[model samples]
Target: MAAVGYTSGDPRKVNDTGDTLTGGLVLSGGGSNLTVGGSGAVTGDLSVAGRLSAAGVALPTTFPGRRAPFRDPTRIVTHFQTGHGWATSGGVDAPTTNLNDTTDFAKGTQAAKVVFTGNGNLDISGLSSIDLTGKAIRFQVKVDDASKLSQLNIRVGTSTTNNFQWQTLASTATSKLYRSGEWTTVTVGWADVHGGAGTFSLDANRVPSATTGFTFIRFQVVATGGNCTVHFQSVEVIDNVSATFPNGVVSLVFDDSWDSQYALARPKMDQYSYRGTNYQIVERVGQAGRLTLPQLRTLQDQSGWEIAGHAYTTAIHDSRLTAFTARQVDDELRNLRAWLVANGFHGDSYAYPGGQFESTTDGASIEQIVSRYFSSGRTVLSGYGASTNVLSEQYPPPRPYRILALSGISDASGGQGLVSSLVAAGGELDTCKRLGSWLILTFHVLTTGSTGGDDGVITQANFNTLIDAINSYGIPVKTVADVMRYYT
Candidate 1:
C-alpha cells in the first residue's frame, strides 16, 4: 500500500511497482500527477497540482489558475523585448523615452519606459490599418509615483489630432486612490473609449471601420508637479470575449442584509417587476438592523430575488478570508455555503466582505477556497480603493471569482443628485448597450431622506428613480446569478 501520512507539498514518494495496495493513499507534489494502476485503490482524499486521470478520464481537481473560461487568441502590438518603432515628442521639457528599458517590465526582459516632466505623448505613427473591431486594448502599466502624475490618456486613431481618448486616471478616479508602485493590468474595451476626454466619438470617426482600421496608438501623460517614470509592457489588442446584450444587462446587487433593503428597496423594485441580488452576511440574518430569516426567504421565494452569500462570519471584517490559513478559509466558506443550502437558499454566488483579495494577505489562496464553494465572487469597487481591479466586469469575466462591480455611486466623482445619478447610470448603460457587456450596480443601505452622506446609503427616492431609469432604458435587469448563467 502507498504511504498513508503523505500530504500536499510533502517530499514523499510512492511507487506502485505492480503492487495491489488495499489501504487509502495520499498523492501530492509540485506539478506532479499521481496515477493509480494495477488494481490500486485510494479511498482517501487526493491532492494534486495537475490533472488526475483515472481510467483515461480526468478526475475533478481544483486547478486554481485554470478557472478562467477559454478565450480567443490575442493580437499582439508590442512586447518591448526587441526593437519597436515608437518615438516621443511635444512637451515643455521634452520627456525622455526608451523602447527597451531592461530594468522594469511585466513580461520578457525589457519594456517601454518614459520619464515625463510635462505634457507629452509616446506614440507610433504611419502604420497600416490594424482592425480593432470587437477588440480591447490591454497592457500592464507601472507608475513610479502616481501622485506626481496629473493625468494619463490612451488614444487610438489615425493620428493624435483625431482619435478616441480615455483618460485612465481621470475616468476611473484612480488619480487620488491608486498611489502605489505596482504593475497594474488594464483592460479597455471599445466601449470604454467612447467618451471621457476624447476628441470625438468612435461612431463619428469611422476609425475602426473595415475600410479604415486604426492607424496609431498613443500614450499621453501630463505631469506638472514633478517628474514621474512610467513603464508600459505587453501592450496588445485582444478579441473582446464578453457577451453582448442587445439592450445591455444590469444587476442590482444590495450588500449586507439590511432590513431597509427588504422593507423599502424591495417594494420599489417590486413595483417595476424587477428583481435584485442580496449578498447576505450569513451570520447577520436575524441580527438587529438586519433582515430576518422569513424576510430573506420572501425576497427569494416570493419576490424572485437571489440571496447570494457574503461575509462568512458573524462580524464583517476586512481581509476576513485572506487573514487566515487555507484550512480556515475552506472551513468558513464550506460552513457558510452549507448553512445556505440547508436553509433552502441558492448560494452559488459570493462577494468579498471588504474587498480583501490582496497579495499582501495571501488572498490568492482565499480565492481558491472561495471558488471551491461559489460559482462567482463579486469584488468591491476599485478593489475597495486599494486594488487595481477594473470598475466593471466584462461578460464571460476573465476571472469569475474576481468579478468587479460599480459601487460608491454617491461619491463626488460619481455625482450626487438624482439627476446626476441618472445621467451617470445612463452613460454606463450606453456603454453596456454598445458593447453588450454587464454592469453590476452595488448598494448597501437605503434611507428615506437625504441623498448625500455615505457612499453606501442611497435615499429611497433616488433608488426608485434609478430603477425607473433602468427600466426606461429597456435593458434587461437581472440578478447576479441570472446574468452569470446567461453569459456562461
Candidate 2:
C-alpha cells in the first residue's frame, strides 16, 4: 500500500512498513504500523514497544529522561595525590614527600605542600562545563610563616583565555578570613572575583571566558619578604547560600513605667503572646500614675517584661541634660543602676530619659558612662541593631557599640491620637521585613483618655491596634536584653 504526502512543495509517495520511500514524505493512516526509509522528524511524543534507532540525528533541545545538572554539596575538585591532574608552575617546588600529617590535615590524610622559592602557583584545569554562578570556593591552608607571603591570590576563569583574580587581603579588609600560623578555611564568594588590578580584564559584556565554561582555578602565593611553606587540602566548590536575616524583629519599649502600662498594656500584650521592655524611672517607681516596685517585679518575674533603666528623674531630658554637669549625669546613672540592681532586676539595658542623654553634648564621655553600667542603650531614633547592621554590611574591624534606636508609635507630641501614626508604624514594620532590620517602638501611657494628650498617652484601643498590627506581621517581639543576646 502507498502512503500519500507532500514535501518541498511537491507530492511524494510512501509505502507500507516493508516498502522504502525514495523522497521526503509524511505518513498518515488509521493503521498502527508505518516505516520511513530515510531521515524523519516527529514533533509529538512517541511510544514504541521495540527499540528505536536514530543514527546521525541531531538531539532535541531537551531529551526525555534526562537528569538535572549534577550539583554536589561539597564537590571536592582535588585531594592533591601525586601525579594528580593538577599542573604547577612558577617557582613552586614539587609535591612534598610527607603528605600525611595529623596536625595539618583539613580533610583527607594527604595534602599538597608547596614551598615558594620565589612566587609560586598551581592551576586546576578540566572543570569547564560546570555552572559556577553564585558558587563559593573553599580550601584549607596552613602557612609556615605568614609574614613571608604578601597575599594569597585566587584566579578563576573559563580555561586560561578569560579569568578574574582576587586576593585574600581584599576580603581580609572587610572580613576576618586570614589568621597567621593556623589552618584557616578560606571561602571566596564567586561574585567577589573580578578582573581588575591583579585580575585579567574581561570583555565588554563582563563575561569571564564565556566561550568555554569556568574550568580553570589557580592559587598563587606571592613572595614579599622571604620564603615560606604552605599546605593545601580539601579544595572544593560549594553552592553558595548567602547569609540572611529573619522576616523582621519588633521591640515594644514602654518608657516612664506608667500605671497604664502595668494595668492596661500588659494584659493586652499578654493576650497576644507578646512582651515588651519597660524603662522604669527609679524615682517614680512607687508614686501615683507609675508602676509600683512590686508591679515592676511581677512584670519581670511573671510576665517576662524587661524592667530596664530610664534614669532617676526627668531632669535627664535632652534640653535639661545639656545644662547638667558631668558629676550630675554620673549621679543619675549611678543611682538608677544601683536601684535596678538592688531591686533584684539584673537587666543590662538602659534607655535615655525622654530619649535624651548627656552624650548629645558631652560626646563619648556620656556614652562611656552609660556603657559602664549597661550592655546596650536605647535612643529614640530608627535603626537596626548595631552588631547586626555592622555584620550585614560587612563593615571593617572594631565594630561600634550599637545604641538601639526606637521608632515611636506616638505622634510628634508623643501621643497616639492620630490613626496615621499606626499606619506609619505598619510601614516601618514592612521596612524591617524588607531590610531584615529591627523596629523598636516607643509608647508611654495606655489610658482611656484623650488620644493625643500632651502627657504622651494613648487610648487602650489604639494600643491594642498597634499590637495587633505588629502581630499581623508575625515578627518576634524581643526585649532589649533578648536582642542584645541575639547579636552577641
TM-scores of the models, in the order given? 0.68, 0.46
lDDT of 2 by residue, 1-488 (tens): 23344333333334443435544435332213345655554433455543343463222211211111223444677766555566667876555523443456656566766777667787778774655554556666777776676667777775455566655641222122233565655554422344533244544322333322567778887766656677777676664422223555667888887888989899989987687888877777788888998899889998998888887776564344445666567666667777787788857777765444434354434555666667666665332112111111110001112343443455436322243443453344543443344456778877776454445666777777778877776767877666555431
Which predicted model would earn the best lDDT?
1
lDDT of each: 0.65, 0.57
Worst 10 residues of 1 by lDDT: 382-391
For model 2 the local lDDT of residue 31 reads 19
lDDT of 1 by residue, 366-462 (tens): 6666777778877764422112222355555656766767765553243322235433533555556555457788888888876634567877877
In model 2, the worst 10-residue window by lDDT is 390-399
RMSD of 1: 8.2
